[model samples]
Target: MAADPVVSVDAVSKVFATRAGPVHALRDVSFSVPRGHTLGLVGESGSGKSTIARLVLGLERPTTGAVRFESVDLSAAGRAARKRMRRRMQMVFQDPYSSLLPHLTVLSNVVEPLRLHGIGTVAQRRERATQMLVRVGIGAASAGFYPRQFSGGQQQRIAIARALVLEPEFLVCDEPTSSLDVSVQAQILGLLQGLQRDLGLTCLFVSHNLAVIERMATEVVVMCGGRVVESASTEELFAHPAHPYTRRLLAAVLPLEGDAPPLPADDWDPASLDDDEREVVRISPGHYLRA
Candidate 1:
């Protein structure tokens, strides 16, 4: 997560009513996913990353602000209108095992959205689903098998296939690789990046993992306690994290085996930098360490 680069401001908030009372969810969160760009929303559990996913998908409306898709105000749209808009956007949830229908066959699961949307004739829908499955590396022979038959990675591939079966303009991936083995994680990510490139997908990729976000997102919006703590292009955010929380996140990153953070050259002095930025010691021109 990157810091708010422009100006400082006081925070507003969002709450939900329940029998227990109002529970705070989000605070003055704002950012946009440009056409064909991936907006990474990274935060710890209960930080409202998934809440933003639901809001953007029109499954939940923001209490104070609006969630727009292709200039359509989803928060204000009618049910019928939202249904129509849903065809152009799709979501892949964290758990591939649960996100997909266990009872349905892989082919049927992918075809469900097309059937619901009345997308095409039965034959055409089956063809589309098959094509998607093939693209995601699931063969036509495995299409008749139920979800329980596939490995977690395979199940996720099927889930991604289902999400893309509609040829969606926007893709919302909510921790799509968190539950897999390390090797499988890379495979899934590579698959997603390849798909995103080929499809020109505008994506909202949510994850608590900064490494994954760095690999996937074009721009990033860092959320904490339901508030957007920082927003910036991926390079800018990782190279120059401005907020204290953002810096903490960077520090928390575990370096890969045989890799370590590079030390500063020691030629530069703290007196050379701006007063506001002096709190963090410069590790390099674009890197910092909280003093």
Candidate 2:
């Protein structure tokens, strides 16, 4: 039998009231993340991908439906309950520069979560923080330095250490490597993969980079207009993308190499497509198509 999902999102939707009217951010979006697996949520800007992450973290509430963790409804939980649940789930943000506090030492940043959760005594927290830093490839000696003392890659390593210091079961990585150099990105991804293997952690990786998603995700979900347009294993999605929108996205990033030619300007027009062709469609098993 399939293992039970660590997270279950059911018919979730979100709408924001704007001066013009209500903006529907997510519509009947639903998916589940099984224990110890990574799911990549991919989409362009304004595609509601980040919104889903925010909703999962309880930064915003859905207009409809529910979000559950291990069969417990987070959407319906009280503040104290949600706070408690947060210990099991953590987020690693996109920009390492802004994520870490400039004034705080690396050790303090990593131990803050533990302190907030009242995990242990000061000495214990310090020991755990040092160990976590080592796990992320940052030496314990670097723990006394401030965020400004580190390079972009090292700062990100510190951020990862902070996120994992609590030993969370699930991690929401919101474009964590997007702001780094190509080499640093690869290093960070490798570090994350190693940590996941060592800890058996589940991950919700959100990114616009198809190549990055392909490398990190066991399964992938493509989002558009705040809803899932396609969902499939990384291999299957790349081998045979069924959604027209998904195809267009792939085409935009096509050639996938330095030597490939760009698409013709005329072929980029969106107004020329039919409504169904523009919409996302559910296709083969474990795969959905948009148009």
Provide the overall lDDT of each model, using Cα atoms, as 2-decimal numbers: 0.79, 0.85
What's the residue-level lDDT of 270 in candidate 2? 33
- The candidate scoring highest on TM-score is 2
Encode model 2's per-residue lDDT on 165-272: one tens digit a residue: 988999999999999999999999999999999999999999997778988998888887677778888889888776655666776664556744533333443323
RMSD of candidate 1 to true structure, Å: 7.2
Which residue window of length 10 is worst by lDDT in model 1?
A: 1-10
Q: List the residue pairs that clash in candidate 2.
A: 243-290, 279-291, 280-290, 281-289, 281-290
Residue by residue across 28-94, what tens digits does model 1's lDDT show?
6666677767888887788789888888787776778666666677867898999988888899999
Best by lDDT: 2
Give the lowest summed-lDDT range of ten residues in model 2.
268-277
In model 2, the runs with Cα more than 4 Å from the true position are 1-3, 254-282
188 in model 2: Cα distance from truth in Å?
0.4
Q: How many backbone clashes does candidate 2 have?
A: 5
- TM-score of each candidate structure, all chains considered together: 0.85, 0.91
For all candidates, the clash counts are 0, 5
What TM-score would you give candidate 1 relative to the actual structure? Answer: 0.85
Q: What's the residue-level lDDT of 229 in candidate 1?
A: 61
Q: After superposition, how far is residue 281 of candidate 2 from its true place, in Å?
A: 6.3
